[model samples]
Target: MKFLADNKRTLDALNNWVPNPIILSSFFWGAGNVDQRSIDGLLCSLLHQLLKAEPGLGPQLLTRYPEWTDRATYHDWSNKELETALFLAWDLPTRTASLSSLLPAAEAGIQGSMQTMHF
Candidate 1:
């Protein structure tokens, strides 16, 4: 949850502060998508900003998580990352209940095998 908290603070600052186009692009890049090149560009832009803001956090984070440089490989993130990204994207709103509410009922007859899998 610390990532989510930090992301929220970052967003709060963004809401009150206007960053350049490059930083804006990075924020959009954090939204998961299939385009590897675009994601890489965004990550680089974010790194640029982080380097300016904290100096050390950028290198520390990148050194610890080098996979972040490769969007194709990094796309399949762990649940924690997904949760953090969702929290960041949605302003840290309570999503557990809403997510459950949004699931289609079994009787809706969706045809995906993954949906029918049993834990």
Candidate 2:
């Protein structure tokens, strides 16, 4: 049980780093008609490239929107929901500023870490 719990926690943490389901779904929708295997391969390739180029962006997005745990689940989301999630994921500065304002604890934690890292 503990192992399962720990694994779930780790997977959840990792999901935070990956792209949201809606983004993935949008990409797939744009991929045009293709065999399932090829589509999967394309998506994997695109996701790999995205992660390589933007290291923490994936996790940051996942952290910002916990609803995007499973990519498949996003297929059912309304267009408005998808748009909102995409906006949040793509606009980090705005998200960060909003978060900093809404969550004083996050701001304090960041400040504390910055203070300790001073050379």
Candidate 3:
């Protein structure tokens, strides 16, 4: 939310950015398109990348929204949500589609970890 407030253009682009069509397709008839676990993992990996991209976002977010910054308040954000804000804080590189395109190491490492876990 802080990221949304701080960076309108990026948020708009993210909103307008068309998602990949295959992501909406189910493996079988009437089944979920993407499994929840895969979704969560992808989100987690993405957020981690976003935070790394914008190290200063967390501090600014906390400062602007102290209620959230204070744990006693509604600081119920999961790592994914927080990291998503960090990602949104970033300016999109020219013709950037996926961060993984620019940093293959991150995606490769994630795939390696998943394979090791057999998940």
Whole-model Cα lDDT of every candidate shown, in order = 0.34, 0.38, 0.38
Q: Which ten residues in a row have the lowest lDDT in candidate 1?
A: 93-102
Q: What C-alpha RMSD separates each model from the true structure? A: 13.1, 17.8, 15.2
lDDT of 3 at 71: 49
Q: How accurate is candidate 3 locally (lDDT)?
A: 0.38
The lDDT, on a scale of 0 to 1, for candidate 1 is 0.34
Preferred candidate (lDDT higher): 1 or 3: 3
* TM-scores, all models, native as reference: 0.25, 0.31, 0.31
Q: Please give, for residues 4-116, the per-residue lDDT of candidate 3 as tens digits.
A: 33454654565566432101110111233232224334544444444455456556655655655554422355544544443444333212233221123233334543342
Per-candidate clash tally:
0, 3, 0
lDDT of candidate 2 over 35-98, digit per residue (tens)? 2223233333334444445567678867877776666743455434544444444454321110
Candidate 2, lDDT over the whole model: 0.38
What's the lDDT for residue 6 in model 1? 45
